[model samples]
Target: MDHAELTTEQVLNRDIPWETYMTTKLITGTCLQLLRRYDKRSESYRSQLLDDDGPAYVQVFVGILRDIFKEETVEYVLALIDEMLTANPKRARLFHDSSLVDKDIYEPFLRLLWKSNWFIQAKSCKILALIVSARPKPQDGSAANGEASNSKRKITTIGDVLKGLVEWLCAQLKKPSHPSRGIPTAINCLATLLKEPVVRSSFVQLDGVKLLVPLISPASTQQSIQLLYETCLCIWLLSYYEPAIEYLATSRALPRLIEVVKSSTKEKVVRVVVLTLRNLLSKGTFGAQMVDLGLPQIVQSLKAQAWSDEDLLEGLNQLEEGLKDNIKKLSSFDKYKQEVLLGHLDWSPMHKDPIFWRENITNFEENDFQILRVLITILDTSSDPRALAVACFDISQFVQQHPAGRVIVTDLKAKERVMKLMDHESAEVTKNALLCIQRLFLGAKYASFLQA
Candidate 1:
């Protein structure tokens, strides 16, 4: 049977030769006693034993994994541990008990991650994540436990364990061991592990942020929806970290997130994506980008829906307000200045508004005409036809609106650049260039008539 399809219940059904292992000295008498009580037992029975001596069982299991090499026995031991953790996740804390402090608890699972079938790899990944999360904080040094001198017995550092796990998870994301389960398992574990700051740092350093962007689309099936939710959850966590946010800002993350939020009916999916947007809403340029992506109307449409999650509702409200503020801010001269300074010239409504020109024309003289100089630079260098046309039209606007518009433009050497574009292939560029030259040569009054 393919291990990829094997479940813990199925693996637990097998009867192992505990006596033979005992006879061979592979497992001590104490381990055999624990196994006899745990193996093939009902849930109530195993739960009692775990509740009584959970650390002992954890020690036996970790020891077997450290010593045993037989595939069948190893799978059985891993299945037992996986089942125990699934039953009561808090039982993971047993692996960190002071009694087991000298044991190298993390090495077996980290080693199995690279050398096993899909079942073993998946289970090891999950178990390792839980154990790492349950470990003591560094601030609680060995002195607090009165075992300061025993620190030398520790085999693996938390940093090494996290880095190893991140490498394995990234490898699974890049190439799956199981055709279907590999990516989902990797993402599931990541959704939990990334809550740790160290995991987030390691993931970002590995360039794993891009690995998640392709998974951010709207999911249809039950399984796919859960995967999408977890994927977005990972993104939401990363949004709190600056380096990850920087990567997200540059990647396709925002557009893909908007696409998912726009189409998803699943409340959890929408909630997480909205929360992610709220986190990014205040970051650099994301405000303008979200507004430009038509998020405000989407927020309105979402508000009309009857979502039960209060966080989602509150997020919708917050995001709506934030985007509204962005729209207002973008409508101001500062927004226009940002657009021009960033060299993303476009024919947004402000470009042709007569009132806009009249109201803010003199404001352009601040900083030695920094905004106008950038416009002239755009004419000299921009390749996008729309950008070039918008640049030409804007320079013409300054030339017409400012009292010394023509003189200032000529002194800045913009007339020669505008003249060179008079015969360009794009009609918009040619037309705008002609208007600019007319304004420069024939003055604002005649230029306005020609523009009309």
Candidate 2:
């Protein structure tokens, strides 16, 4: 009810020790209490506030939970959290400092995550995300000394809850309905859980990789690009562990990963995929296995990009120009914004790894000319300019680098695409396209074709 502007310092200044929230009644009870007070304002709000001596944040969180529990007002609750978390992630992290890991609320809330309503599922995932990603402060500890300090007991309780959460999340992905909606919400929460090393281990223990890897194949945006991108990132996070990496070594994930990387025009998906490959290549044995499976060529193709900024490629700009009209007519503006925010992956460390790129590129025959066809089509139709530009660079490099490159390029009719691209608006696209055509012309075998 109090709409006063609480500054960052004020919001963070916890009025009660975080432990008070651990009491079962604090969340649901206080929420219901607060809602009743709001509805029946005949009584003084100050008198009601004075009656409950709990911290301001308790009321704040209780208020948050109360609104989310309501079927109608849940969207507003999520939007407020999104605003707070975006303006200052620490604001939400501050709220997360409270203990809400109770199976009572957590389990039921998680069940709602698989429901058909988008707001219900999204709000549920956001709550789970807060729980998993928030790092507890030292004060959040000593208060729980009686129970939480008992290290072994604490581990048992936390581990059991994590196991259940992980299990339910895997099930949500397999659910037949809500492919475009409910599943993405659940997938986002699963990806958040992967932030913790301990949680990541539990995910693998529950056969999480088996459930996730199949979703990566060829389905980037049936619902939205966020689902596919987050799924890839979660798998990338899992790859850091020996057990998950070992599973990927033997599983069908590699070929599927290859296909996604080669064809996906989604930026975040492409970026995280590089991280995934780096994780695999870091392991010497797995690196060798992947090379044997023909991953090196896939990595090499993306590596050969000519444009400095992949987002600005000429062909991709034209593609999006064509797509923008349909996007506006078919969906809301919010949908496009959601795609941008969700697809944004943090890849700073990935680029810093010299060994990752060094190990990924090997001098060998990429005998599959089908790769040329894929790149040629990608160069022409991809909405991400970087993808289009990269396709151009890849086709040029494939023709120039491999011994049989010319034969592959000539057979694929790649020269025609490159020539059309020469007149493209982006200088980078024109540059890469011309470079590709030049490679074709260099060979005497294609010299007669150039004349035509």
Candidate 3:
């Protein structure tokens, strides 16, 4: 019985009575230890588990967990759940099977997931998503009423799960630390849950639309940006659900999305925002929301900007293609002017329309110039090559207008930095800087100081 002499096979196959050894202490320490060690060396364990000649040890070891959860002991059940989640994939795969899932175990499983330490909570949420997704659908019997009744029951179950998950999800997202882990895990869980039609129906039923504002809000961390995007993607998928599109339109998400599109400095964030915009706008309900949020100006800027960053630009183009039909919504905002002026301006696909000058530019009497000044200040001091490039591009577009250029030239100190950027290594920077230089000299006539 010496530990070093015992192989995993011997340990697994050597069964002690569950009643004797599966008490609270044994469940927390010894059982968890086995699950951890097996999972830690998962590849090796899996190699053995999946092999045709593999020993029967894994099945026996897994049976311990099965027996533990069934022991009518809450302590043992919670500990077993933790062990399965923290255990390596090789060991965890044993628990992944649907045989372990049941209505009685479902709610407790969720409670354990929601309350676990942050590191393991991610895996816990994923497990819950899988369990809900795999729940059996009711039979499609010959009785017409049977199908309807089954559908209603399925919908009801999905609603309960969605509400529970969302309630837990909101609390998790509010945590200040480790959004990098929490957000993506939540997003993946949401994505997985969407696989079932009943779940999709429940997603709409559960006020998921209202949940999106916080997901995409400025209060969110940089870590949550992609997570927010993925949630937006979830909303995009749910766009087809009954009344969901209308719900999203009424919710604050679309305006927030437009703000992210207009204001985000990160290229990846912008790419995601635009793509989500495209997806939402493709549908009539959400498309109107985009228009109300000033979709025309944003789309115009995006189309004109060169966005030479291939990966980022490619993402933006994909978003554009997704919303290609919705481009019509942008027409009345001065389609002719933006096309005639910016048809040739090479800029990031993430930029807004330049033609707002003629129509809305003159009417900026109520607009906040403080933000514009702050943007100029940021562009002057920023060292990030990508950000500097975007700043230069935006400033140049703003200055292209005859009156605006003259006004900006008097106030915006762009010449000093454009010269410094002559030494920049990034093509996006050089390209954007060169455009700024061209505009500075061409219309504003600041070339003398730039040359000096």
Clashes of each: 0, 1, 12
lDDT of 3 by residue, 388-437 (tens): 67666656655664465646654556677676786788988888778877
For residues 171-283, what per-residue lDDT tens digits would candidate 2 score against the true structure?
Answer: 66667234455477668877788877767887787777788777777664456567778888888888888888877777788777767877877666777776676656546
Q: Distance (Å) between predicted and true CA of 8, model 2?
A: 25
lDDT of each: 0.89, 0.54, 0.52
Q: Residue 437 of model 2: what lDDT? A: 80
TM-score versus the correct structure, for each prediction: 0.74, 0.49, 0.48
**Best model number under TM-score:** 1
Candidate 2, residue 77: the lDDT equals: 41
RMSD of 1: 9.8
Candidate 1 segments whose C-alpha is farther than 4 A from its true place? 138-151, 331-452
TM-score of 3: 0.48
- Put the candidates in lDDT order, highest first: 1, 2, 3
Q: Which regions in candidate 3 have their CA more than 4 angstroms from the true location?
A: 1-108, 114-123, 130-167, 170-188, 218-222, 265-268, 285-297, 300-452
Which residue pairs in candidate 1 collide?
Answer: none
lDDT tens readout by residue for model 1, 1-452: 88889988888888889899899999999999999988889989999999999989998999999998887788899999988999999988888888877778888999999975988899899999888887767676532111222656657767788999999999999999999999999999999999999899999999999999999998899999999999999999999999999999999999999999999999999999999999999999999888767687688889999999999999999998998788777756877876786577888999999999999998899889988998999888889989999999998999888888988999999988998999999999999998888888988767777763
